[model samples]
Target: MEHPSNGLSIIGCLRPAFYDEESYLRGLFHNEDGDGYASDWKDGERLNFNSQSAGANICSTLYKLEIMRMELFSVYGVQSSISLQHFQDAEPDVLVHSSSEIIERFNEKGMKSNAALKSLCRKKGLNVEGANIIGVDSLGMDVRVFSGAESQTLRFSFKSRVTSGRAAEKKIQQMLFPRIQRKKFKAHDEGLKNLDSF
Candidate 1:
C-alpha cells in the first residue's frame, strides 16, 4: 500500500480474515466518494491476480521481510529496533528513485561473479547462472538468482546504513569495487592528515 502523505509504497499480504471485506477495511485506505477510514488516501488501486501467483509473490515478500528481520535482530538485538514510525516517517524516495541505477551498476559489474553471490551459491549448492537485484533499501538488498529450473532469493546487508539512493549506490559500488574504494579512502585519509599538519 502507498502512504497517503508520502507516496512510499509498501507491499505486504493482507490477513485472510480481511480478504472478503471492503478494500478500505482490508487496509486499502481509500474508496469511492472520498469517505473511508483513510479518506485522504485518494488514489489507492487494487490489482487482482491468480491465487497461485499471488501466493508465490506474497511468500517471496514474506521471506525477504523475514530475512531483513533476522538481520535487524542480529545487528540491533531487538526485533522492534526499527519501529513502524520509522517507515511511516522516513524519506525513502531517494532510495526508491536510485534503485534502478543501483541495479544496473550491480548487473554491469558482473553479478554472477560477485563474491557474495558466489558464496551464497556455494553454501546453497546451486549453480546460479544469472542474478539481478530485485529490491534495495537502507539496510540491504534482495537479489534474485536463477538456476536451470529453480530460482532463489538472497539478502545482502550494507556495511552501513544509507539514507539516500546515491549513498546506497556508493555502498554497492564499494562492495563491487573494494580495491577502488580502498584507494579512495586512503587518499581521503592522506588529505585529512595533510590538513591536520596545517
Candidate 2:
C-alpha cells in the first residue's frame, strides 16, 4: 500500500499460497539462528535500510495489517476491494499528518487517562507500564503492550466516530480528561444560559 502524502510504498504479501511461505520469507529476512537480516528500500533519490529490531518489525507488521484490514473490509467481517480514489474520497477517521501528534499526546497522558483501555489491559493481563499507541483510526486505536520480552497489540475502540484530525483530538481529549471536558461544557452551557437571561 502507498501513502497518499508520501510516495513510499509498503510491500508485503498478506496471504501466501502455502502456509510455509510466510515462515520461509521470515527465515530469509528475520532468522534468529542466522546473523540477522537487513532489508532496503530505494526510490531513486533515497535509500533506506529497514531495521529488523523487534519493536520496529512488530510496528511495521501491525501497521500493514491494520491498513489492509481497514482498506479491504468496510465493516470488519465484510470484504471488498476499493479504489484509491474512492477510499480517498471517503474522509478517513484520522488524517495521516495528524496521527503523529495525536499519538504523542496520548502517550504523554499515559494509560491512566483511559479507563476502558486500562481495564482492557488488566483483563488481558497486559502490563501497561510501557504500552504505547501504534495506530489509530476513527473507530479505535492499536496499542502495543509489553510484558517481559514479548509484546502484543490491543484494539481499543472509541465511543463514537471521528471524521477529521480535530474531531479525533477532541474525542481523545474527552476520553482522556472526561471531568475537565465536562466542566468546560458545563461552564459554556451556563454562560449561554446567562446570555439568554440577559
Q: How many pairs of residues collide in model 1?
A: 0
Per-candidate RMSD, Å:
15.3, 16.0
Highest lDDT scorer? 2
Residues 153-185 of candidate 2: C-alpha lDDT, one tens digit per residue? 666677887788778878766554567656876
For candidate 1, write residues 1-198 as lDDT tens digits: 110111222335443222333443434433444432222222233223222332353211111121122113322123334455565576745577777777777767674436545555556576676666666778887766766776656667888789887888777665644676568768999999999999
User: How many pairs in model 2 have backbone atoms within 3 A of each other, for residues 3 or more apart or on separate chains, i.e. clashes?
Assistant: 0
TM-score of structure candidate 1: 0.40
What is the lDDT for 17 in model 2? 26
Superposed Cα deviation of residue 50, candidate 1 (Å): 36
Clashing pairs in 2: none
Q: Give the worst 10-residue stretch by lDDT in candidate 2.
A: 1-10
- lDDT of the candidates, in the order given: 0.54, 0.55
